[model samples]
Target: AIRCTPPDALRALTRRQVDTAELYYIRGDVEKACELAAAAWPEPAGAEPPVRRRALALYTHTLLYTQGPAAAQKLVDDTLAQAADDPWLRSLALAFAADFNSAGDRPYARRIAVEAIKICDELGDRADPIAAAVAPMALAEIDMFGGRGLDRSLIERARAAQSGQSWIPFIDRAEVHLGLSAKHVDDLGTSQAILTRTLRQAQDVGESSAMLILQAHLAYTELLSGRPEAARAALAAFDAAAREAGPGIGEPGSLTVSRALLAIMDDDLDRAEAILLAALERLPPIPIVRVVMDTPLGAIALLRGDVERAITLLAGVLEQARAVHVNEPSVRGRPEGDLGQALVTAGRLTEAAGVADELAEIGARLERPTLTGIALRVRGLIATARGELDEAEKLLGAAAQAHAASPMPVERGRSLLALGQVQRRRKAKTEARRTLQEALDCFTAHGHRPLARLAEAELARGQRAGAGSVLTASEQRVADLVADGFTNREVAARLSMSVRTVESHVASVFRKLQVRSRTELAARFKQ
Candidate 1:
């Protein structure tokens, strides 16, 4: 007769601890699983090397999900060292290695992940399909951040692996991960539906640990949908779940990060900054977590008009973002656009032009017209600044069409204003006058008063142009300063006008003289 033994006693006779830990994990009994996994060590150390390797792989895997990659960093190397001949174990080791490196060194992290996938591909269906299935999830994690295309087939394969299995291995994580991916890809409905289902399942199983993760995700989804109160409610649930479950995967720190994001959306930059800084201090440097916290912090610096600080924050963020480009491809556009615009705001148009060129390439590759249009608009503005009117006109006209398709009125208006500025610079006063007027109207309709005021100034410049037209006394003074070889900055200081206003006046002076640059205006008047 078979004797019924406790799980730990059964562990001595078989690989039961590791096996049961796997069940506990899949069922979302996270703390219980982790404890059992940690005990799987000491190990069935008396077991054959392969069994020991499997135990180590399972233990490290549990740590990775629960405590973040940094928490598992040391174990990755130890597991691989001991499991050298087992391709499945080594592949798992490599995946955790990638996750660990994701925080600070992206390129290195990707190399490790590629090697892991390679091993899995070679071992596909031969060693362990369960292990093979995880490779794609690893790739998806990397690809999602880089704005690279995330092949849904990878996710589909992961989901398929759980079928016909009574235990529903890997915690049915594919659904939740896919839900997270949807959030990245701007498919909020799919995300919500999938996550809500996962949440219900976790609830049915009484897996409060998984509930914390699912709730945090739900909060993020609500935040993206612009339902802040719903997001807050979800976060509150996540916090409550964490309190109950003892900080499972994506807990405590993820809660803090979510709160910071909500504060940012509410325009409470100070609170966002404080929360982010504290989280960064306390949390493990997981790549996804780091980027989530930093992106908004940088944006806040930009919004505060701390141009240098914004550049410092955003430029570093963008650099790391590119290096780790495969993490979340769907969520990359806004940060890229923000950095480019911050450069423009700082009057770093030359640098902004380079950034715009890269963004345009990325946008085109992604086939995302909105990002493409924004990139084109930035390029057009840069060309206008450089006196490249023909190129500016082409870029801005294309941008306007793209933004109209996007239905983003403010962006379209900005493009129109840029096109008008180009026309004004090219001395096409009739076209410039009409175009500038249209831009003013667009900006006014959008409640973007500052840009509207800029558009108005452009219109005033067009109206004050020509020998036959009556000049505003202010226009007359700006025109004389430009004709006397003063740069827009100098004219701005002399006339108490903003530099942008001075640019408009100077463009008017050029149109009135039928000249191009300030040099041309100086030459014409001197001659």
Candidate 2:
């Protein structure tokens, strides 16, 4: 019976082996599988028809998993060259290529993914769920790069096709869920649940590497949920899993960088600095989310009053961010947003406002409320500095609403603080008090110690009206600038008026308020 085994049975054995290898490769056991597949490849000269082709495909994935995209590219190209007319080979080849391209320098990944998706769809019952998963991921990745709204149509297509599919589809589903959650941070519960399920499935199938990745995602989500301790625990779990699985288990540099951020959040500046420095030194030059990593590090440096380090890191990050195609989706518009914040802190309000404008436009297109709120807040601060109270009020109010819509408690609390400041300047003392108190409560609840402290300080100052109801046009201009918190020069340039005109307004406002300087005017409003 063994000697007389049917060709069909032999072919089935080969297919099962191929599938097994794929499972191992995806789970991060690339080195072991690749070596075994390489030796076992070149199937018996006259073996069943599908055996050789299946082995080639399996070997391609093994190479990809072990050596990354470049090696995978060669295997796909070679396979396509050999079997130019085979629909199965073509579909597999193109799908792998598209997956590689999706991570490449250009945006060609989406196009290739779509073509493969079409081929698979036309192939009907034989369609590969893996290809289907790649298609939408590529498309969504493209949409993210442009800072544009994601194509729900494509995402829905992937979701519909993933029903009862294999591990590949589930992995893809996890990615899609993460993308959506990133866009809508308020949907943390849904996102976390999706990741949890995906991780379980991956673990059940021995896809340890994928499980680790999903675990990291869950950790980050915990960070967003304001559970730093839980986030740390998750990261530690990932670290242990990674060590057990060995290398080839996806990137860990970013995870290490994330740990630094947690340390910073905990107010452990020494630990944060030590971790960041170590990770930065060990990480490869080709980093994933480089700008995002650099921006947070810069923020920490700035917080520690390491202005030189902040400038170096922030400026370097911004340059790289701008150098990119300006359309990659992973970091969203965070690079520009970070730069704007850095510029504002460095007293470059004009540059900050410009960047904020760009970020706002991008965020609007993406329908990401948190980013929009950030952009608006930056602009509002600029306006306040320019003495544009009316404009400041409008921008601040919009920012507050956007923050309220965001799922991030910390962001919401910060927005409340900024809005309260604007209201206080408007002489709406009751409203300001209410808003400020709400901010204090939110920050306190969220463990945002610094913001809560600031809110408390603002609330402790009794309210006072520095400017009267009936003011001259010049005084009105000054009031606007004062409320917006703009510099004299910025106000003049924005209004198309002279610096002397702005100064004259400020002088007149000082006389009316009987205040010595702008600082006194601001203090009076707060009091």
Predicted model with the maximum lDDT: 1
Q: If scored against the real structure, what TM-score would every candidate get?
A: 0.68, 0.75
Candidate 2 error regions (>4 Å): 1-16, 26-28, 39-58, 121-126, 159-170, 173-187, 203-206, 243-254, 305-319, 326-333, 422-433, 456-527
| Residue lDDT tens for model 2, 384-479 | 767787898788888888887777677777667777877776778898899999999987776656456557766765332435565674576455
The per-prediction tally of clashing pairs is 13, 25
Q: The CA-based lDDT of model 2 is what?
A: 0.65
Q: Which ten residues in a row have the lowest lDDT in candidate 1?
A: 163-172
Name model 1 segments beyond 4 Å from true: 1-16, 19-32, 42-57, 65-73, 95-124, 144-147, 168-172, 186-189, 225-233, 243-258, 285-290, 323-333, 383-527
lDDT of the candidates, in the order given: 0.66, 0.65
Residue 228 lDDT, candidate 1, scale 0-100: 65
**Model 2 CA lDDT for position 251:** 55
Candidate 1 per-residue C-alpha lDDT over 195-227 given as tens digits, one digit per residue, 9 for 90 to 100: 888888887777665677778778877765546
Residue 137 in candidate 1, Cα distance off native in Å: 1.6
